[model samples]
Target: MTPLKSGTQFSFDLLAGALTGRDAARATGTLHVLGNPGGRIHLRDGGVICVESPGSPGPDALLLRTGRLSESEWTAALTTGTRGTIGETELHVVAMMATHDAAFTVVAGEVEDCVFTPQTLDTAVAMSVAIDPVRLLQETSRRITSLLALPCSLSPHRDRVAPVPGADLHDLAPVREEILAHATGRRTTRDIAFAAGRSVYPVTIEACRMVTDGLMTVVAGTSVIATAAQPLVPLRPRKPPTRRPPTQMPPTQMPPAENPLPEPPEGDDGDDVPLPRSLRRQLLPKLFKQPERKKL
Candidate 1:
């Protein structure tokens, strides 16, 4: 088995930005290529878990060894040319692992140096196991395979920052330049938030939203941030239902309640009387008057 190498040294900010999926190749993060194909990748907290690539026979076997694809994903990719299609949710994490070679792609943010060769299902499985558990869960939910899709058409935009989808420029404009300035493949979300005098959650949410909108990109495994321009994917507008005529209702006066409460039992005790025998006994000693003691 061969260990993966770091692609580049990247900060959390750059990684976050790249993961946002608006840019391509920020070059700040390190990508370590394993000498062998189909290495296992391990991740934690949305980061790489680890990778293992055992040297063995056949290119297909090696592809399987990467551990990125499921049996079905592999079958689809080998048979159909496209297996794992990046959807809206997974793109943020998937785009972070983009590499020069189209045959290999990062899965679950961690498993590394995998090639989409046939007969390598075992390798792909192993690689997937190496990914971070949380990310793996997310990828699994989205049905992403470990194998790289052939003739990969998806590429990160270069250089310019694209607008985040559904994000208003007016609201973001106040911090826009600062975000761009600090996007230097350095700085963590905490650092950026502190510098911007905002909470980390809001910043992170905004950053992720922006990435989904193709306004930014992140380094593969680092926190470095960068800007990239992207073709805007238009959102489909929802149509409003046609209004219906209001139904006429006859006006009526409300009837007053005859009684707010039912009368107590005819032989009811005082309002303060205890409901249970045990409770009455407990209160009886305190409430009942003791026989007047005769003057000594």
Candidate 2:
């Protein structure tokens, strides 16, 4: 099976939307999808009956290859509705499983578009039951959750794995053993499923377990390398720069006081110089005009 392509995004919600619309209208037809492993979803009264995808093993492939029914037996079931050993109930179970499984691969990958062809199944096909589309999509979501929870998330279509050298293989489950035996570093888990004559889900899950057990390693240059979520370190807030106090200036010095008056010399009080006019007038009153006895 081709893995979901990188760079082209697809979501389960898109598939859900399409199915929900069909369910509301009670439309019966085939929803043909185009993508990496594009295929068709056949609906009966808005319920999904069969899903066919290049990336998945359909009911016919599972039934015929798994040896539940031989070629002649399958043809009889299709042609004459004869279920000799594995009866019609077996056919229904196989068909349901195939539809659910194929729907998962389709949703997990990319879908370019879904164009509904208004038609009904002829009376010749092996599948006679129509599955609830809502239930199918819900189960697809559950499968996605289970896949993401795996210790190692291996894309069935993207990541090819290789068996570890010198690894112990005794007493292991048949499915895991089959996975390791077919792991050649070039074939992906989907391919391994085909080779082992098994379904994609079990093979992929086994591959994940092998990866976790260290019995296998994903080949280099696969998309599965970066599929797991990485832990992030929380960022610390930045601190403000430290402020310096303003520089202190020395106290300002006052200049020496200037001498406004000259220092007095000794005996400088002896009057030698003429008095000012204002001072003479003041002194003459007491000095002369001795009354009016005057110049007698």
**True-vs-predicted CA distance for residue 254, candidate 2, Å:** 70
Report every candidate's CA lDDT. Answer: 0.31, 0.64
lDDT of 1 at 235: 19
Q: Compared to the true structure, candidate 1 yields what TM-score? A: 0.19
Error of 1 at 22 (Å): 48
Please write out the lDDT profile of model 1 over residues 171-245, one tens digit for every residue: 455555566456554554334544554433234334543555555555444422323322211112125545656
Worst 10 residues of 2 by lDDT: 228-237
How far in Å is the alpha carbon of 29 misplaced in model 2?
0.7
Among these predictions, the greatest lDDT belongs to 2
Residue range 133-220, candidate 2, lDDT tens digits: 6567656655654555565767788888998889887899777778888999988888897877677866776687788898998887
Q: What TM-score would each prediction reach against the true structure? A: 0.19, 0.69
